[model samples]
Target chain A: MASNVSTKNTNNSNKNGSSSNSVISKLKNTFGLQQLIILIVLFLIYGLFAALSPAFRSGSTLTSIFDASYYVGFLALGVTFVIITAGIDLSIGTSMMCAAITGGVVYNQLHAPLWVALLVILAMATAVGCLNGFLVAKLKLPSFIATLGTMMITRGLSSILSNVQTETFPLRGTSDGWYKSIFRTSGDFPTGAIVLIGVAILCAIILNKTRTGRYIFAIGSNREATRLSGVNVVRSEAMAYIIAGFCAGLAGIAYAATYTTIMPGSGAGFEMDGIAAVVVGGTSLAGGVGSILGTLIGTFIMTVLKVGLPYLNLQPHYQIFITGFVVILAVYADIYRNRKKNQ
Target chain B: MKKKILFGTIFAALLLLVGCSGGNSSSSSKSSGGNSKNIEVVAKGFQHDFWKAVQSGAKQAAKEQGVTMNFVGPKDETAIAEQLEMLNNAVNKKPGAIALAALDTKAEIDAIKTAQEKGIPIIGFDSGVPNAPKGAVKATASTDNYKAGGIAAQHAYDAIKARIDSSATPPRIGIVSQEVNSLSISQRTGGFIDKMVQLLEANPKIGKGKVAVTGHDKFKNKVNASSAKAIIELRVPADVTDAAGKTEASALLKKNDTICVYGSNEFGAKAIINADDSVGGRIGNTEGKVVAVGFDSGKLQINAIKSDKFLGSVTQNPIKIGYEAVSLAVKAAKGQKVKNIDTGVKWYNKDNVDSKEIKPLLYQ
Candidate 1:
């Protein structure tokens, strides 16, 4: 096993050495083929929608897309770390709901400040992530069941917390109020895109540069092996969750800002889209081998598909079939590619 | 674990601080007796412009009445259970009065009764709890949805009669509704079916009385129902007939020859309009082209109607309903007797589409 690990490391270094200068290296270094696919898909979707509906290419439309993308994007980014470790966090969607409602209840209904509301969101999300990590890393619970339970609990709590309704911030006009431009897009581009870009850059830095990031990849590659090598498996897993929760909190805030209302049921069934983006963008669900760049492009592609399909006069029901097909195709491709890598 | 809990608690505290600060800066200075007594209007989700229009009307009435109004609803339109829970919470606050768009007709009775017991009158808007004890709230102000459906059928028959020769094959019609249980939706569909049946009986010609009203009734009648058989055998009237049930019926119409498709709600209408590009075949001598009419205002429905994919639809005065509901609620809450207010529905077509009467109610 040690020899195999050493050989795999040597091959990774050797491959990195061979294609160090080409544009291909730059693309691979950033996001790789998945990013390219995402870009192509986004453009194709834009063109198709633009042709079908004249309003599709308008600045407002683009802004709306950016607005829609912000929360989902943040959720995707947070989960990217968790995914890279071959773990899934199904709780992000409900966790987002809990955070948003907690913030809304604290800030809006209770008349709290913006910072306090935001802190509550982040703190709630982080804590949930920690709990998720505890079950998975320490108690040895399967990631699926742990997160699923958390998802159900969080969803119930969100509904309980807000009592099921879109809670308005009650801050119609305040100078310090972040409503006007909290993670906003300006001019032709939404500020959400800028935030997405910022997050992408930060995630890239973390995945590519940080020790914790490296440890995440190592753990993803082989958990037991990393543990045998004297790494704190529990700590690394917990960190991944903490990061995931923080991203969810950020997403909750961005969602509240963009939509201007936090509905407990707002982020329903959105986690699958994040997982789909990551997987479609070349992140293997098997863990250890994924890129934030790929995930961004994947998200872009999914978003495009979501927005563009309806404009083509396709029934909304058909989207379910399309999404299901894409998910199956992605998982199959991942398994195939991972098998090839092993051989 | 303790450290995580401590961090979570501290973070929660910080959130409280941020929330408090944001709230403090936004406090209103102009009381004007509006903020003195808060009036809560609980709506069913605001996905469509209908609820927003209702809120606006309610707000206008509230402002005139010197009351502060707050609007709230679940995100998903169909989540009635959530709305019920919200009503309970609102009752605890002891607001001046509660105006609601009940998600569930029967489940809300208990809550409405509780509000009544507390002297917090619950006036329903858009949707009502018909059996909310006695004087649970003075009266309901909403569109006569059933008559609206009948009105749609009348328009469809008029259009068909004017266009088609009576000597030719009688054009068969189909109806689709969004939900089997939605009282308003079902009533509208029933009205349409009733009108269509009347037309068929009077003429003794359309489909020789074989035009099956395949919706809730058909499903209920079925013994060990096969969805496939239902899909294949059910004859819908048009591609996108609004009010709901339009999508499923539209898809079924494509497979079968349906001349006129009727959707019972906005979702049903959207389903038909959405299937416009891919639809084919004729029901009887209608050229395999099923003339569709929809309910509510959706981007797809608007575009389709503009492009002639659908003929037109019945328009409900949702804003007026909203305005009247709030006005009535406020009056009743203040110990004044207010009778049931009727915000009528009207037939809308391309000719009068831009008119003020039809414009406000259209789903854009």
Candidate 2:
């Protein structure tokens, strides 16, 4: 009886050990633990900045970066999903501006109830995204050119809608409403950082654990093969653009929250930051691979550098020079890695 | 399967929660303050740091005066179209009063006219509505821009006169005016020209009232002809096409020596001082190089003045103008009549830039 009981216990222990090992192996295989190295590098860079500038570590300073980061970070995340499919989205930034401005007009100017305005913004953003997807996937236009066209059109549309200045949310004499609450919560850096983290997790789940996510990567890696496998290439690419657009709307709302009014050209030149973050985050511009985590960390690094350098008394324009250097270094490293992988 | 379900459930739940909460929060923000007795005061816009400073000052005044200030405008730089639309929308809302910096002097008159008809008092600031109908505005509070321009010209003469007195030959002077049509920039140029003319009349030996015609000497003589020569050889920034000479100011300095560079506006001033050719080198018999004077206080201009790169600049009480504009609106809303107020401008050299009164004008 004693020997039988010992045998049962030993069998249970062995089963548990193998299950844990399989889980570890699965995590390693699926998520790419190797990329955490970049995260560590980002952390070290942040640490260096925090140590160098007294203001860099201050709550207000950190918060300022976080505040700026939320808009940029959200845009980067949306672009990440698009990039993973080996596509690009240049219109996300302007589309967000258009969405915010349109929403502002509805909610603030026209006095439409706040939720109605938000839905209008969401619908507008999604429609623009759909238009981008339709041109790229359905109409067979090059993703780059398609989005570039969208960027111009959306920018022109935003200007035409607002006539030129930022449309203030909640209007004057009205308190901030639902639009402001979701996107413009008060409290400094961590609030923005926390919001970004929450959104990042949602994107990670959508990208990594979903069927659409798998198809995005598969299509990016080998479009012909993905088609042969009976996955709809057009749908996958279109979906990517739609996702990017939805995220842009989210980013726009975030921007309106943090800043009092959206400036004309508010989202202008922001696509560069998204592209930079995606490229730096280890997404090959050529297609088939990316890291949401890497992009998140990349955003942090960029935002910190942007906010920290200026606080350290370095001129604002000088930060652009450093960012260019970082992008070059990232691309060089990526090329080196590709060569190693090929070998 | 359970994990996937949980994820799906959470995602759906989150969306619903955000959607529901978003609806509730926006309504709450809209209703955060139920006091309808408050007068709505809309600022023209906050595109630049100058606007931000003005907004802050106006808000402070609003709080002290127990009025609500609604500061909103187009988010773009120099977007008059958006400003015009906002004015129309503000008037539609029937705000107690609206304070505006007319985006265009003439384009916004219709909206101002309508708002006046509605009995919503309008107070103009910074760039006042010059063409508003007689009864359209309650009062205008701004720097006497014409006077301010005249001051800039007077200072230019003072600085140049001292240098000319010490020189063997007459010193050539250059003017950088922003827009020929912009009353402010043109007035400053006019004031400077008027002052130079007066000085020249007073001392003809100094070569006053003389126009230096470069390029075609024949064109110089035909003042009324199509290609008439300039009386004063001015090197306006290329961006200022209408300013007698539209070539970049640097080219103007290169073409003529004995040039005393005066920037008629902020952009003109910045371009003149920052130009590579603006290095200190003697102009003709003048022992020192071109003395650069500009209008407006920007960080670059302030620092330049501090370092003696510029002789001095005219500092307008931009914040005072914004604050008074809002205050006047509130008073006018309450049936109190407010007259045109002069916020005023002052000249700041390196020595005075650090002074308490001047420091507030220098954002940096």
Candidate 3:
């Protein structure tokens, strides 16, 4: 077990740089000071909340933070690709709810097995992604406008399909309840955090390593230039939306596992939460620059504040109010970086 | 980099501390329970004045019991996942006891299970987590909305009896409900319909073949709308929105035979009041006015009652719901026997609306 831990650490250090001195030293070259500061800030805020409220430092409270972050973390990771391609997916939030409810309806109404319902959720979300890709890439619709339309359409569709009733997944102890263990176990371990971190790492690889990743950056940097250079800009940009849809599907699964009751007309504000995390993670709205690692840190920051504020007996609105300032500060950092580079 | 980091850290710390200090003072003032034995309350969002009344009541109970309380809810009712997170955090606090108004019970199963296992007794309030695990929920504090609905019907029946009897043409009774999906809303709608129908049947002039119930396919019956001596029609909108509710209410108001109308909650009552404007202000009880009876109180409904525009409204006493929840929670935490507490309802009109007894119960 110790060897396993050491190997994972070795793998992580190899990915970041070479020999592991300090994690900050390893990451500073690739990500620079922005993410390091944000990382420190996330811990600092957490420490402050713990100092103020004795309950905030409990193990269960950490689990609550992980529970809250799962869906949004998956969402932020997925939308990172699209944001890098200079596009936005307004439908991911509603689309995730719509797809998950359809999955639940399949399980209950169709009497399908739980696994089949889970697959249907993934397939339905990907299909929404395909539609998004087709509209923006083939039909040349504005990504924002196209996704906005799908957002409304999917929002209505979920209600129509579920008959406006709430759909619930199996409880953690039921016959088909093992799916919940994918996120959390009966022993109170939060396995979802591990799954989320793994997905984030994989998303980072896809965004930074592969051809689709490079093409996405190119298109965001200069769409006309990328197109003129014989890269299939439409297909590459569309792939980003498709990736987002796939992530939304994963997010839907995480949502179902973590919070079993799925309601229609929900998942609307979720996209904004996801988008805010991405923006807060040092991703420019103008696109072409973002890291999954930064996005991960951003997700933690958001979830920590959300879970921590309540420990101090603060209302949820304070989280939103403070997060607004945090996002503004992060965006200013991006603007400052761009200004410095131009000068 | 050091200066920027220091500045950012200070900025975030200052904001967080400001929030902490400011929020703690307000919450402490709300309860004044220095004992630090926390009772966490997770409620349905404050969609209307209803929840504010509930909060005030919770504060009342907390102050009396000498237990600090932390109250939180999602931004809106549809945010079920967010509510679950709140419930989970409530459990995580390991409060002395928990008072929960679950938005979706099935979604709350896991968190409730955790609370149960941890030996933290949970008191359900305001449509408490129905069908929760066998022993997870200790007791519930809520108005029996169906009973509350019946209370409205009894009052409405009294005011409209003469109107229905004197009408030469078969009089029509209308019901404007917000939606039919939720247990609380639907029960209120069903309760009023069933009770009013029962009351109308017992009357010598309007028995058996007189009442025809119709609308939304849920309440359709063999009695024809045109042929029956009187009609009991239910109007549930396509969605829960003010405009849709107003439209449904207006459709009933425009009909010439309609002599009385009922709205099940604050939203429904407000819709009826708003719809009355488009139809030349017909709702009242003085003479030829269409008698209107409503459930729950709001500013508009209170004003309407003051002017005799509405005959009366049934109020659920949300503050009592909040108060009882914390009281029950404290009892359960003390390992004392606890059972379901019905934080009953009241009917108020111009006669009693401003009276000391009824004034505290009415919201807005």
Candidate 4:
């Protein structure tokens, strides 16, 4: 086991050394060329919208952009782990919504305290993630099929739990509305930005500096080899799913805080947004390579497109069309870079 | 061991799916069986309290009329394909009659035709399918959405007209609609914009300057937006979520010259109220307050109206619409001559919200 760990470290360092031999490759290795390019694209989109509509240039518009990012950001951050392990979680979107709906029911119908309700949201999401992990890690089911079933289950459960009613959280001025401050201040400052950044940094540390993180990367790179080396590959892979689930829980809370109402079966397409963010942020769907920072940047790029398109006097359908093109372009860029690197 | 666990997980998932579908089928069967005539009512979705109230009303009508009403809806309003499938299923059941709140007017034409071929009379409710095949639809029970929007506009204009007269600069009126694609929302928004423009054009003082209506392209072409005195800005979000609506509301609220705002639906109303809360502005007819008028009645919108956070709102008669739809369907099933019914709408302010006429129509 000790030799395996040392050998993995040496392999990582050797790759780093080779990539740093050229100035361009050094920049690519250090900052991640894909993330840098996406960041540039984010700024360009912002600039384009600002140029098109004077209303888009205001602080409120920026606040709206930040507000839209919270739930998607957390979902992207969590699912980055699953994707990093060469796994998919189609359930995250609906799971987050289901968790939020559960919390809403607890708070509104059951008259539970806000803290208990928040914890319930986290617990529900974590259990779902564990289920996904158990199905994939232990049962060896395809991640796609496992999460797809879980997605339908969670969505259906959410509708059943809320009785098909739109569950609303406490508004900002209400006594129990302090939770809204976690995402935005009463004064309308983007306090959620600070929380998102803090969470991103914490996730970065866990992904880069922790033993569990190393094992996760190892399992993703080669599950068979890692298991042969006597690592607990199942547990490590399951832990990745658990982390994804926990992140989804946090996203549920963010969603409840940011929006006025939670509707059942409304979150079906949201996972695609999170997955797109992960991909755009330079996270490989094949796994073994990803960063929390890249996912964060990717999430902002998506929100900017969603919130910015209206300012350009473009219809909402145009935003969807442009987003499709953007995803294709980003993935193409990734493919091009990989080919160049191999050559 | 791995194979066993995999099979177990698959089995569990299958069990869950079977359980859900089983529940649906049993409930539907319970409604369909017995001596009572079964009438399947397909709704847009049960996503809102409005729909639940509609379902309750339908149930009430079914109990009173000695008929069995089977209500089913897609999980969300955007599930057009799912809704089509539900309509097909309702037709396959060959129910006495089918009452539908079609999500897409044109998309359901084929289903309407199918019901026609199957000799199942179709009654349209909430939103009528205007372009359905000839003789396919027997009657429609719906609130006059266009007139309801005009009522909202009339009340809003009454509140803000004083401000319009006093202000030297061209004041702005903002309309936040949930979406432009839905016929119900389009009519509501169009009615408001048209009424506001007509009112402005009638007044010589306001008519001195041009009235420009700008926002979504479909609405922009409906009114003049160039060289305007009162700029009627119509904003519809990309989607039907509160997040999208709130973004549009906040943008409309940012302009200092804006005097009044109208939210065309429940989602839009909540979005306006939310934007107002975040932006911290008075929403009333008093000096320096922006008049906020809304449509539909939800707890949030009702409370906002009661608290003076909103000027007023146009409340749709969803329950009556539901009852009337089922009643008409039952009558049509009996081969009785039935005509279109206007369930009507009421403009409820804080004073009239609890009034005898408006109290029962308010869903929560």
Candidate 5:
């Protein structure tokens, strides 16, 4: 509202005040209005939970909140790119588990080092992402159908590759336990939060300050206009999927670190959680408008609610019920914002 | 351009067929070739490690009996319709005998009735079909969940008795259950409460009405939490996600008066262990700590026992359940008198966790 008002004033008044208004608009553009709103909602929810349950205010609960966020955060980050391009990737859930379990296989059966196994997990998911890209972008299949097929494929593939067994990761104090420390040290430091934030910053740069980023936005807003403007829409669109795939890979690692047991048939409903976080963060499912900042705050909001609800001794069902309301309200807010922008 | 589109459609259709066929063939490949009798075994779909261990035992039994065994289940445990479809398909296959672990027996009445009409011997394993058509389930190979829960309580009571007796205020014993909807889980949870209440009542300091049973409505007694000599709190997460489970477990661990905590199953056990990581050194039999007793065995639970964070755990013999179900099915197929099998449970701590007797039962 402030930016809109200042712009009108600048057009009506003299040139002297235009410079300051322009700087203010630029500052507002960097953080944006919707993101700031969601950020406030995140804090408000935290304060409410804290007020209701003293245990929710403890440091350990904060760690628990972070523990829940790592994988979902990475997942929301990756899918943000795909959602921005107006395409959905349903396979990220199963594909993430498929890649993680395969990485466990590589570590256990092949005796690969931990770092090598992590790389294999990332590569495996990216490969699936590439396949999703090929089907949706090149073959002209709808993104939904393409990802749905891959979702079932990866679910079956994870079971087959691991022989329907639960793959075990290293425990704390083992030689390769250092990998678990990527998410948290044994002393209870949540290093994974730092890693999640750093990655978010990098993704923000790629989406905002890069050529592929502009193409993704342009393709989402007007595909025909982008093609007419001689942009390589196919390659740019494919990069979004690749990024999503890579993020799912990162999520796979985070999941293994936090839970330490990656079972077959895991990751079935996980895509919904990531997609929910993205939409709640003010990213329009209709596409062409989103921010990594919104997604980061969105992930925390979901996690804090999940982790904090237990403090009130509320059952998991109630938490799910409340989260359903939250998602609907966030989407409604998005619609309301869009309507106002148009008017 | 039209011809190319036709070619593309055919190519994609072929690929889809190939993909489906590839998945189908692998699952079907488990049964043996040749003239051997085939036995179809359907177990619970969720919890891969437990089911896989059972399958391993079934495979060994199939080899010993010279019969081909095919095991299958629905993707989720609560998928009643999907489980019914699988049961129907198993009956339709006309195998010599069928072994079923029904998630809901009434929902599977039609398929169970079909198997009985066809004179196929039906054996139950795990939480076998209870209250099925008169004699539809000829025998069940399962660990008595009530007895199993009693075993977990007996062991846990021994370690926490002194603390309960000595505390000025009523000491708290916490039970973390994954959920109370399932029969086996409810029985185990109920049995634990009954057994613990018995033990506390037996003590002179805490008589019958002095002990409070609180939490979910299914298990709550009339005794109030604050006025009681001892509190037995039962917590069940609304769902089965690890995060929810962890939160439930952590809540129990966080209470100051909590002297002992017990997790009902592998999921509960693993949740307690994960919750312990965030809380740090709080789950042990020491001063200002909690003693955690777990049911079932997973690597994390096993590690907890070895490290002395847990008092020990009660392990259900999944392998025996699998082996016995297949063995009984073979006998019944040959028209021999077959009775229900009771695959029992055992209590193992750090000392015997890796013992030869117990090691095979722990699937990681």
Candidate 6:
């Protein structure tokens, strides 16, 4: 499986070298042309919105964009790994909300310290992810079905735990509200943006520089061949889901910080945004190809469109339609680029 | 193949267990006695404290009236199809009467017709189906949402009239409506916009200058906009989420000329408060403070009003709406003439929020 992927990469690079001898084309080939094109599209959307609405260019609007992207960014980053492993984690959205709601219950109902509740959020989400991994890897359940069941379960659990009440975290001025500053400061600075970038850098390292990452790519490329090579394919596959779960945990914390009120059943559609971001970032749903940096860029593109649509005198509904088109375009670009390489 | 079969069996058993547990938990009450009349009350949803209050009110009425009240609702307001299914199930039971808070007025018309065909009476609450077929709906119990909105507009106008008269440019008042799809919300937003415009035009000082009502195509089409001394800007979020509400509110609150803002529901009110907290915008009639008014009461909104974070709010009597709905249903069940009941609304502020008259109506 490893040799197969390496050979394909070489073939694509050779195709690029033969197709275009220009220095610019070589630069594009070196950097990955698909990622470059996506980056250009992201900037074009941002620049267009800025040009259309003066308010879109302000510092505060930039802060709002960053605030909106943190939770989705973490989800996208984690799910990118699962997608690359030829798997899906539909539970991340609800699991993130449920984790946050559990943290709220611990803080408000059990009188736990704020720090303890934060740890509880991370632990709970990771635990859910481990469950997802166990179902998919150990039991041989499909990732889609396992995560879908987990999604409904977590969503119901959240509603039951919170008792259908909106769980509000402490506001910034309150004594226990200092934790909010982890994502955003009282002065409205986008501290979460820095945290997201740092997390992305770490994920990029894991995906590029580690044995587990290589094994994951190998398993996705050819699971049977990877097992034949005497690799623990089950453990490697499970690790991908565990990584997604950890990211979901972090996403829970980010969501709690950005929108202090956590309502049960409200996070149902959020996972789609994360999945869309991963796909738009050039991560193939078929697996074995993705990057955390590309996911980050994709997250910004989505956030920009969400925050900018209202400023251009367009209603929020238009954002969904335009985003749908952009996702289709990004995936089409991916398929088109791959077809070119094959030819 | 053996492992797959084992997994499938376990999964099936787990699903069965979950299904049984869900059925047991959701069935709140069994039929009390053979002689007791059964009345089913289908609410919008149990997503908020408001619906819980409504359920309690219905239960209280049931206990007093010596009837069996089975209260059920969908998980959230967006589940209209689920609600319709529940309504159909209620009809199948042949209840003496059904009290409904219809999520979609049009969607319920057929169900109402079916209930009528089955000789079951339907009583509407919270939101009434204005266009229901004749005799399909016996009566309705609800607050006059339009008047409630006018109350909000009245208080807001009183606070900002001086500023409106004195500002060199047109002063803006923003309304953050949760959605336009719901009859209650649309009426509330429209009520406020129309009343605010009416007050502006009625005042000699403001009427001398033009009055413009803009933003939100639904409300914009209803009012005339000209070069005016006052502008009422209405904003409705694409969806009913805290993030969307906050975004819409923040956009309106950020305007330099915005002197007042009104959130038309609990979510909308919280959104306004959240935006104010983010931007450090004060909420009161004092100089430089943007007066904030809200509709509906929640713990957050109540605290905000108490802390002077809001000018005041217009609150509906949800408990009364529930009680009246069941009462009307029972009356219709008895073959008596039942008329639409106004559950009423009141404007509460920091000074009167704890008053006896206002305290009972305030839900968590």
Best by lDDT: 3
Candidate 6 has which clashing residue pairs, if any?
Answer: B210-B228
Q: Give all TM-scores, in the order shown.
A: 0.50, 0.52, 0.83, 0.50, 0.50, 0.50
- Tell me the tens digit of each residue's lDDT in model 1 across B39-69: 6677887666877777778778877877656
- What docking grade does candidate 5 earn? incorrect
For candidate 3, write residues B97-132 as lDDT tens digits.
899988878888888888999898999999899899
Q: For residues A293-326, could you state the per-residue lDDT of candidate 2 as single tens digits? A: 7788778867766665533333334567667767
The digit string of per-residue lDDT tens for model 2 on B48-79 reads: 67777677778877778876566655554455
Weakest lDDT window of 10 consecutive positions for candidate 1 chain A: A1-10
> Cα miss at A274, model 3 (Å)?
1.8
Task: Score chain B of each candidate by TM-score.
Answer: 0.74, 0.75, 0.86, 0.79, 0.81, 0.81
Task: Show where candidate 2 strays beyond 4 Å.
Answer: A1-34, A170-174, A177-189, B1-364
Q: Chain A structural similarity (TM-score) per candidate?
A: 0.86, 0.86, 0.90, 0.92, 0.91, 0.91
Candidate 4, residue A260: lDDT: 47
Which regions of candidate 4 deviate over 4 angstroms? A1-31, A340-343, B1-364
Clashing pairs in 5: none
Error of 4 at A232 (Å): 1.2
Model 6 Cα RMSD, 1 decimal: 23.3
> What are the runs in model 6 whose C-alpha is more than 4 Å off?
A1-31, A341-343, B1-364
Interface RMSD of 2: 18.6
What are the candidates' individual DockQ scores? 0.02, 0.03, 0.35, 0.02, 0.01, 0.01
Candidate 5's interface RMSD, please?
24.0
Model 5 segments beyond 4 Å from truth? A1-31, B1-364
Instruction: Give residue A162's error in model 5 in angstroms.
Output: 0.7
Off by over 4 Å in 3: A1-30, A134-142, A223-230, B1-36, B153-262, B266-283, B287-291
- Compared with the true structure, model 4 gives a TM-score of 0.50
